[model samples]
Target: MTKTHEGYFFEDYRVGQVVRHAVPRTVGAGERALYHALYPARHALYSSDSFAQACGLSAAPLDDLIAFHTVFGKTVPDISLNARANLGYAEGRWLAPVWPGDTLTASSEVIGLKQNSNAQTGVVWVRTTGRNQRDEAVLSYVRWVMVRKRNPEAAAPEPVVPELSDAVDPRDLVVPAGLDFGSYDFDLAGEPHRLGDYAVGETIDHVDGVTVEEAEHMMATRLWQNTAKVHFDATQREDGRRLIYGGHVISMARALSFNGLANAQMIVGLNGGAHASPCFAGDTIRAWSEVLDRAETGAPGVGAIRLRLVATKERGGGLRGADGKYLPHVLLDLDYWALMPI
Candidate 1:
């Protein structure tokens, strides 16, 4: 019988140690369709095979976050199995666009570690890289997590924390080569908003909702290779409900913003994001976006827009708000940056 790898202890990791995660996935039209249905993504290149071919891609590729999830999911056994909290991510970049039928694999190198003062926990940092079948780098990021030590009395390991970039510079943003929205169909893309129309500090209420389902989430998690037990196995959860992946909600909200924020492009900064409330199979997910800031990137024909995406559930036959905050129906609060046509 093949033994299942539960996870590793804090004592097991060492600087320079490399951990390769298993299971590569091939994205397909179903995932693409689900992405559009879940969020409202209208990027012409990703929405239509014909349009993608015009942009030089053989077919519509998977969304960027899909690639991130596929890569990040691989590290769960090596990184977050016993984690108390995900500290942060830095220097994250998407190098190459991933297409359907492309296989994605990932590995992470232990970069640094710090034994916490409490002794029961320590912080571990790793630089994770995702590569496609051809061995080209797809995405990379540095992330740290607070991991609980099995034994508080264990001897402390050498403390090391590598310095990471605060944000990927705007000039460093890579636009998909040959991408041209000049002949893009605004109506078919689901929005008429253009890069020149949006003003700074504008808030757009994306008027769409999707009630997530257990089967849908399981399919998504498995598709990403995110084998987090709680997200799939009902027996592992106390309430007998499958916990949805946080990133799923994030992508859903980001896609929903497409209605009025279609030009919002590459996600440059993930300042702060949260799954504010637990979402279940029957809870309908609705999203709204607030334009937080805007700036010009050095990249030709591209600009950066910062946005806050809020998702909520329907209650009492209508969406409800509690005081100044989103009601318990609120599912997510995400702050991030995106590159857009200018």
Candidate 2:
């Protein structure tokens, strides 16, 4: 039977529980084109069949975050169905690059649980994993959420919180084997920036906008198999408009940041993020980025760049204000990492 409700409560979870989320996905060329048009991403390995072939791949692989969202979205039904808040995410690592036409699926296992002293709420932690049709592990991460207890009179469960790392170690970052950018085309990659050019604290304002549409959001959410009613059923929303998937804004902003941060590769961490405001159809989204931090990894020929990307809807003709507060036109506040050429 299909379980309805997201934002699961504290009383509903137990340690050792495994929730297998439904709906698998098959990636294709359309998604590849969208990745290019959406972000200005021209990584030779992802953009050219010839370049990819030289490196021994059939074609460019899907962006890493695409694999992440596909995996994360599956756990929503069982894990977040009744959540009060998404506490945090840690230990996110991309294990393998996913090629187009590959089918993927995901599942989550509850690792810990804690009941609040108030007896009305508690916390649930889960480790989620994604795999391809071949059953190769593609991505994994840990997340926790605040959930309400159905019965306030019930005794609180013993608290158990798993220790997590502050940041994923650079040594742990996995590079796709046989990835030889030696034959990379600077022109076709869409920019002249290379691994050596970006500074640790530089920011870029990706100057483009895309007017969102209901059909577009629906198609995207359904494509990820994300069935949140608010994102799809207009009637379920108070404003009588479908809520754009937060991931859509994330993708748009990440893609736009490529203009100046083209060499930033492979998101290795998802420290935190927020959908500051609801994005609706017809809202034109634009993006800007701030370099939060940078670290030299032990990996040869690679560095890690952390960025904060903000997506906003243009108010008439110009970008919105900068009080660090999202205007009604704002859509997302994202913080993450990317691997860059050294």
Candidate 3:
């Protein structure tokens, strides 16, 4: 009998199956410190306890993406350990604020599956929910990954692609309890741009760049407890370099957007995202954003702005080439909804 525990392959997944991932994590100030160290995140609401209190929160919540990365990392072993790629994301929403003393656990339900034309790999879709110590869902999203089939000759299962929402309806966006930007301080927040200041289709170049470092990327990945081979093992790919975790790019880019979007405080929804190209250490990542749409929220003085954030290696590289495939320099393309003061 084998004493090893190999992760699930594509064929192992069945629609409607639920999996509670192991290793619940208790997050505290330490994780918060490293997060600030890893990215240039400086959103005022997340930076100051007083600011958060004034905005009706008890204190500053953990960086939204920290909650996101920590929860997403928990699903790696069960979901993407055997993955060829982290394909994309959709219909994600932050259900609550994660406090410092909170413990987070992750679980996933297999909602859809499809064996690809090439028997060697198949796509697995899962709706994942992250819960805090109190058993309240903190975050939820759907992600699909391409996982390799142990045996190429395995019989294909009938595809069960779940019908997902094109975007999270604004009415469904959850504002943290007591959150009120009605008295928000524009000076403290660093940027005076509010929801009305941004026009739909308006593009803003974030005007900053950070060259990713090997030590830093690994430290961030380990801090999140992600053990994906492609992220840590250079031998996993034909190239002799470890692939930078896609979430790293997401956080780095989100942090960079702060210069122009400082008031875009809390991330409440993730409409779609893609790791269009593989990112490796030593790449200098730059970001840009386009305001896609805007809507009024029920929260007092709050509004929702849907944004398309793009991260690239080359300064002027576009997301898609004429052929409709992602340009080589395009690293990530993310569409999300954020809370801004009206």
The best candidate in terms of lDDT: 3
Clashing pairs in 1: 265-339, 266-339
lDDT tens digits, residues 114-213, model 2? Answer: 9877787788989999999999998888888777787788777677788877767666767676655555456665677766676656767788777877
Stronger candidate by lDDT (1 vs 3): 3
| Comparison by TM-score, 2 against 3, better one | 3
What RMSD does each model have against the real structure? Answer: 4.2, 4.1, 0.8
Give me the runs in candidate 2 sitting further than 4 Å from their true place.
Answer: 1-9, 33-44, 54-58, 83-88, 112-123, 146-156, 235-241, 294-300, 314-330
RMSD of 3: 0.8
Question: Quick one: best TM-score, which candidate?
Answer: 3
Shift of residue 52 alpha carbon in model 1, Å: 3.0
Better of 1 and 3 by TM-score: 3
By TM-score, rank the candidates, best first: 3, 1, 2
Q: Rank the candidates by lDDT, best first.
A: 3, 1, 2
Candidate 2 at 322: error in angstroms? 13
**Against the unseen true structure, what C-alpha lDDT does each candidate score?**
0.73, 0.73, 0.94
Clashes of 3: 0
Q: In each prediction, how many residue pairs overlap at the backbone (N, C-alpha, C within less than 3 A)?
A: 2, 14, 0
